[model samples]
Target: MKKIAFATCVHLGLSCIEEIYRIGGSLDLLITLKDEKAKDKSGRIYLDEIANEHDIPLLKIDNINDQEVLSSLKEYQIDWLFIIGWSQIAKKDVLEAPTLGCIGMHPTLLPIGRGRAAIPWAIIKGLKETGVTMFKLDEGVDTGDIIGQGVIKLDQNTTATELYKKVDDMHIALIAKYWHDIVSNNVILTKQSSADATEWPGRKPEDGEILSSMTMDETDKLVRAVTHPYPGAYYKEKERTIRIWSAKTDENDGEIKLSDGYLIPIDYEIEGNYGR
Candidate 1:
């Protein structure tokens, strides 16, 4: 098996590594974000448990492209590096450190949606179908050649949390199915077509703010797009901000009114106090 170094800082990354370990695959090193660096990033989790359990050398880094990280990768003599659930893009030096090209996992199908905040963007854009793509890392954002991909169907009611879990499962499944082929140099990569490519811009917490002018369906999509693990969609009420974690449009008796109708909030929070 090839020497593998994994870099990740979220649940998806953890799931992939765990799946690889479960299949008795070898991991040479584990790299993750430093504690202080993960404060604002949603879904960030400590991967220490997996590293400790497998006795893999764990390196916490603020930047994946730093010289220290490059040095470490060189020291380990890594053959392949899998970077999942990490926000930063690896520079050329770091990407080249591994004997084989670095690999990245994106939530949406490449050559379609190829940038940040893929989950929220998918919902906000009213995409009925999105998929996960495992591709080789190149200079451009998510422009690498595809190694594998799996389709995921989306409904009007698919919340960010639900789609998140599906994407996570797909990440693990991809690693489980392809690790052997990757290590053995038997995997084929298909180049992404530029003519069909589209990009999603990174979303901010303030993007979750709900406007009174928005219709019920728009409000519902925003609520579902940023709920739970991501920031909750909110509306400012006088001196307090009401965060809507979940909502349904079937009821018209709800307190918050939209342009078209009202949404019955399934879950909400006001100044840290959770409510229904």
Candidate 2:
């Protein structure tokens, strides 16, 4: 049986673990980092339960760069290292520790939409298509040779939460289908074209703030992109922060004399904080 080391710190990582076990893949070691107890868009408790269920060797490391973690991984003789949703940029030594090298599962199509929150960013930008990429990890952030990629079309009404589910489904299927080839080092990797790729800086909580000058369409996109599983969008109203759960865009190009910074709340829920 092929031995694989799985490392991650989010719901996606947990899902990957469940999928791997369901497919009868060997999980020789599991590494996870401490994360906030906040629920994801799916309202699922992260990877904690899966780790306990599988009884996979777990490493609760504060940082991936820790020498103790590195030494433990070496002792396990990990054949393949699979990473998903790990926040820290891994060091070269840890990445190359596995005999087959490390593979990272990214939420966006390679060379484009690189960096954090790729799924939400793609939807907010009104992208027609986005997908997942499992690539060889390098020194750079998500800049690696692609081992496999799967694309999916985006619908006009697709919210970030919805798009995430589609990507998650694609990830599970791809990993099961390709794990053998990846572990054997027989997989064909395509080079990412730098010219065709574009990068987004990632969204900050402040980015979710609804600007008074923003158009209805822009506000709608913001609300949809961060609703539910995300913390939702926010705007200041009467010295209190208001959270927007849902919104609809009105394409009225005609002049309506509405005061600037005056917003019509279609649907909302108030939160104590201005931004998450």
Q: How close is candidate 1 to the true structure, as a TM-score?
A: 0.88
Of the candidates shown, which would achieve the greatest TM-score relative to the real structure?
1
**Model 1 per-residue lDDT tens digits across residues 1-276:** 778899998877887888887997879999998888877777789978888888999999989998878888889989889988787879999889998979998899988988789999899888999989999998888899999998999999899999988988888888988989998988899988899999889899999998878888899899999997898999887767888899887535677877877777779988643343
lDDT for each of the candidates?
0.87, 0.76
Q: Could you tell me the lDDT of residue 20 within candidate 2?
A: 75
Question: Which residue pairs come into collision in candidate 2?
Answer: 41-229
Global CA lDDT computed for model 2: 0.76
lDDT for 133 in candidate 1 is: 94
User: In candidate 2, what are the lDDT values of residues 1-276, reduced to their tens digit?
Assistant: 456888877667777778877887768888876554323534333455666787777877778878866787789988778877676778988887877678888878889887778877887888889899989888887788898889989866888778878988988878988877865667787888888777878677788888767776667677888886777888775557777777655453322112232345566877664434
How high is each candidate's TM-score? 0.88, 0.83
Superposition error at 230 for model 2 (Å): 2.3
Worst 10 residues of 1 by lDDT: 267-276
